[model samples]
Target chain A: MAGKTPAGSARSDAVRNRRLLLDAAAEAFAEGGVEVSIGEIAQRAGVGKGTVFRHFVSKDELLAAIMLGMLDELIDTASGLTTADDPGAALKGFLTAGVQIFVRDRAFCEVIGRPSLQHAEVRAAIDRLCDVAEQLTARARDRGLVRPGITGTDVALLMAGVQQTAAPLLAAEPQAWRRYLDLVFDGITASTGRELPYPPPSHLSLA
Target chain B: MAGKTPAGSARSDAVRNRRLLLDAAAEAFAEGGVEVSIGEIAQRAGVGKGTVFRHFVSKDELLAAIMLGMLDELIDTASGLTTADDPGAALKGFLTAGVQIFVRDRAFCEVIGRPSLQHAEVRAAIDRLCDVAEQLTARARDRGLVRPGITGTDVALLMAGVQQTAAPLLAAEPQAWRRYLDLVFDGITASTGRELPYPPPSHLSLA
Candidate 1:
């Protein structure tokens, strides 16, 4: 109680306000893209416009923070996955969860890929994702669940393909993306584990 | 032969000049992206700047014409496929060729997605593409080469994914896209012919 002075209370209050602002900003941006106004985000967080600026200097900065937050969530999800038993299943599960995050958070999906946000922090976040993917993929390959020569970059690109391809389909047929994901997973799995749905390209031995 | 007057010679010269300009423009745009200047294109085609404007009117107009030309080429290729017996193979071949076209022509890829270029003519060219895809997809479905419930839009979306993902990879590894396309194709093939690599998503039966 002696250490809980006025300064301590103010710092705690600032921390709480920051969390509230981030949550409100995420919701606002998800609903109304990255172009959502600072005033709207402040109002949603039950704070003044100045408070929003106090936490985030600009909209781009706010969007970047949101992106970093999402990446952290994805990284945590990947890290928490238990893959010692079935590495393939773990990889698929992580990719599924990641794609779902992209689906639920359109603002994160849109803003992260913009030319302006390709800074070091964002790149580092993406590299962290690739690191997790590489770990999962390596385990799967060792277990003979995944095809040989399949790199983490391949897995990452396939998951990105699913997210990017599934964006428009969300409006008309919400679940159509699941079909494509199934295809991609099956394609990448070792031929011995699952029968290929078709022959590989004639010139290349995909197996 | 009597009709080969000076006016006729001039008309033939104009026609030859137009063809030369288009070929030059295509080469310049493919090499230099959408930002390539009209003067550069004209110089490449061995014509004066005035001649380039006389044919294309503007850079956008030139780009549109190039797009239309590519669409015509695609439509012709699709129409020529002998799909009466092996529709699935035909469909796959058409998609593979289409992706190759996008890879070879960066300007076409860059301009196709621009909001401003979504005019009636461009829309018509795109619709023509969809029409061919639908025809091929329908044939494949009848033959049961592709999985059930795979629509023409799905085929189109997959091709777009190939084009989109392959764009960046082209700079590093030209043939890298073939790997993803192989995965996609194998995934979509009938399970009766090829085994699935993994269990389909639990929520949906991917038959």
Candidate 2:
């Protein structure tokens, strides 16, 4: 393929190399952490050092790309998740799957949490995630899967909450996060099958 | 008092100044943001610039102290809140109070969210928070206020999520966060005054 000069071949090779670098970079960054070097990513990808820099201008860009890839995966799954029979079930599945992604891919999730990425391009990528959330949330509510009062902003907050919920999954107990997700889902989700465990009038309405 | 014991008086004054500086530092960082200067904080607190340095060696230290103070307030409130009729109700109150603190005192909340402090003291404070949440969750379950299957880690994540939810409160729509909070509470709290709002499930169980 490299020997041939087809019109789309170079772009395809570049795309393929970009994916390789992103996957390798994510693994290296997760294994060695955020401070891991570019050369390490290159070595892991089995690509030339120049190729890594060629695909990404700097370490920050590379890390950002790796993160963008994960975010894309997350958003894509969210988009696909809306097609389920029950919107509530789909939303819960989306939340659980996203949590699993964060637990499985720590460095990628840190793209949003890390202070270093407060820079422009990374901020844009992170900011764009809100739209993804907004759309998914709208779809869920429109389908009657979400609580009636749950607006786009509300779902976004819950999404952030879910990420926070995933932290413990990596720590002392992995299963603990699942329980957390259940609590959260129960809070927002109306009781259909499970007896509503929480009684009414418990919390003083701040309103 | 000052005339009776000069040394004791001076020490007490120093303590008062330190508290003032800490408060000033928290406000400055929250209002203007993380990059605000030490001199500015000293000026805000009506202290000499040197006194700011005397109290905290670095901005990071000041931020950490501010976080410690905020966490202290939260823990105290959470402790007091557990006395509600149902422990589950107490947990909800504490969570609401925590949200109010983070929203009302963003600078301190931002200070706690800082990555720098996550290493030592901050991590312990978070662990202690989890402990409080764990006990609260367990007690709520025993009292049957918590929807069954809820866990401490979920509540912890929910607290962090609520804080993040409150961050854009000032710049966004008025009471947008309040709506978010309402929807979130709907999910976390048990149904009251009305029937569960969703379709009935084929199988249901709650202890």
Candidate 3:
């Protein structure tokens, strides 16, 4: 701390405050909400309220940091799946990984849908994650495992669709997400051995 | 307006205030957050501050009513699908119908992972909806139209999955849900000539 220039000292303080704020914000948002007060966060971080304001600039900025932390874990885990030996397995693994992550971080899930956050950087992250989903679908198609018409975007929706039942406060059983996964997979995975007994759809139409 | 009994008149007033408060709260919650004030809701509803309090025990109760209104429509539409002549058609029709209803009321979507309102009645309504979803799967399966291994819960999750993409805010872009439906139908449908070109999975692992 002694030899550092004023600028260097400021940079180090910023980094320390960033981690402290993130940890504090995550706990608060989970228990209260993204609207949890900056004062409460400063108190929880054991820093002066002025220190909190200096670091985040605004409440929106602090919320963004908390969400970024959550998204980082999701992106990193999903990224790992893209490197798995089997493409289908990688995609499935990522879905499961995402589910667990979402379940654990309700605050992140609650705010991830905000259109205001649709900045260039967020869009890039989305596109990269989407590419991961696409690779999984392409791999399945190439291996002759998935059905004919499915696309990567389809898988993205499918991922989002399944997570619907995983609402944190539905007051059902905790394993509701497991049930959601089973059904979602049933909707995508090809039926290999068993012949479906149901009648064929007369036609497929969006109407 | 004058013909009603004293108790009946009070109930009617209560209902009107409830509706007014709910409309205001829904708008506020979507624009702001759950921390939105009762006074703001009263102003939005063009009612006295006392009227808002008279109808709702708390802001939480007002939010719950909004959620219930949306769920009621979903449960009714889904249940109605079972009565259609072609179970397969009914399944698709109702699944799509349910998604439409869900999309029509995006405000309710906000309540998913948020704090609980009251429990007893709210839980019952949710269970009723789950039952409708389960029934959609069972009936679809019974007709031999859904895959052999698929269940009622499967259909519910599939619909919910679509909602995740075709959500209220993103309502204009419903192609995600459509693509998801295609994947779902392809996986579970009895193969006809129009099948997509995915490889048959060797065996689906429970994972």
Candidate 4:
């Protein structure tokens, strides 16, 4: 492996640079806004502006990449949770992960929060997240941990609730989301036996 | 009244046109987005473009007016609740009104949903809303209807959660917010007795 050709190392270097740029961009956008310059992002990544453009043609594309990357990471996390010994804990953990992401990526939250402004990539990511959520929630229900009559849409609503409600208070209380999530978990867990109001929310049908 | 002078009728006509333009702009903005053209809005209002220009100097001002109008309506609604016989019911009704507003006014929802984008008018509205929410929640708490230890911020989070989660589903099912609101209502009500997770949310400082 040490004797690998220059091209192979160059390719690996490119991958590392791209990841760095995405991380840098995410931070810059979250800290400032979408208006952060590409050159600034490249500077943060310790790469040339040409290298940044080489990875993502435009800032919008860079934003899309970050969103897709977050969704892919979420999907990976959700898939891995299937093996967890406690389905209930896995479900709770999934929601907590979502809240953390919302807190971490204000840019991503801004995009997902508005329907009028969402691009195709954002919708795709939400659909994929919804699928993963449905799977884990089903497992929790099967284990008698999650309350009956709760749907994937309800789970989506709960995670979104935590995100939107907690994001603003992060400066004053970083862990505000945790408390809200617990109240939500208690409400939805089987122990509560709480019946949701009639005529459930619009089915988040990905079909 | 029928014998009113010509000048009096002309003044009434100006007032009517202003109301028409505002209502039309609100509908157009909510239906399409904040980008809806003034000419298009005037067309919807059955008025000329000059009428719109006469009422609003620019689109930014128009948006501000709409936001202030919403806040004024919300403050009015909240104030009216003090007359209700049941404080708990009044508090719940206030939240329900919020959901209905979010469902009815997409432009308003977009404005209120993002803390970063909010201007002075929106912040003032939220501050007033928080005050009203505290008053109603305190009354409800005294009546043993609202659960213990819930603050105005908690109530705000719950309402924001419902509005954010339910806004997207309005197209598929208009009453979708009602279901989620009920779930939230249950969680916060005395019947649940559900202890919130440790380290509660940031204190919503009204002082």
- Residue pairs with colliding backbones in model 4 are none
* Model 2 Cα shift for residue B69 (angstroms): 1.9
Output the number of the TM-score-best candidate.
4
Judge candidate 2 at residue A67 and give its lDDT.
68
Candidate closest to the true structure, highest lDDT: 4
Q: Model 2 Cα displacement at A2 (Å)?
A: 23
How well is each residue in A1-207 modelled by candidate 2, as lDDT tens digits? 111233344677787877787778888886555668888889888899999877666787677666666667777777787676776677777777766665566564444443344446555544555566556666776766555544444444455455554443334444444654555565565543433232221111111
Provide chain B's TM-score, model 1. 0.80
Q: How many backbone clashes does candidate 3 have?
A: 12
User: DockQ of candidates 1 onward, in order?
Assistant: 0.17, 0.16, 0.24, 0.39
Alpha-carbon deviation at B68 in model 3, angstroms? 3.2
What lDDT tens digits, residue by residue, belong to model 2 across residues B1-207?
111223434688887887788678877876665567887998999999988777676666677666666777777777776666778678877777777666666465444443333435655666676667767777887876655545555565566555554443334433444544544555665653333232221110100
The reply for model 3, stretches above 4 Å from the true place, is: A1-17, A30-33, A69-80, A118-120, A168-172, A191-207, B1-45, B112-115, B147-158, B168-175, B181-207
TM-score of every prediction relative to native? 0.67, 0.64, 0.72, 0.79
The candidate 1 chain B region of ten consecutive residues with least summed lDDT is B198-207
Ranking by lDDT: 4, 1, 2, 3
Clashes counted in candidate 2 amount to: 7
Clashes of each: 2, 7, 12, 0
Provide a comma-separated list of chain B TM-scores, one per candidate: 0.80, 0.74, 0.69, 0.80
Ranking by DockQ: 4, 3, 1, 2
Of candidates 2 and 1, the better by lDDT:
1
**1 against 2, candidate with superior TM-score:** 1
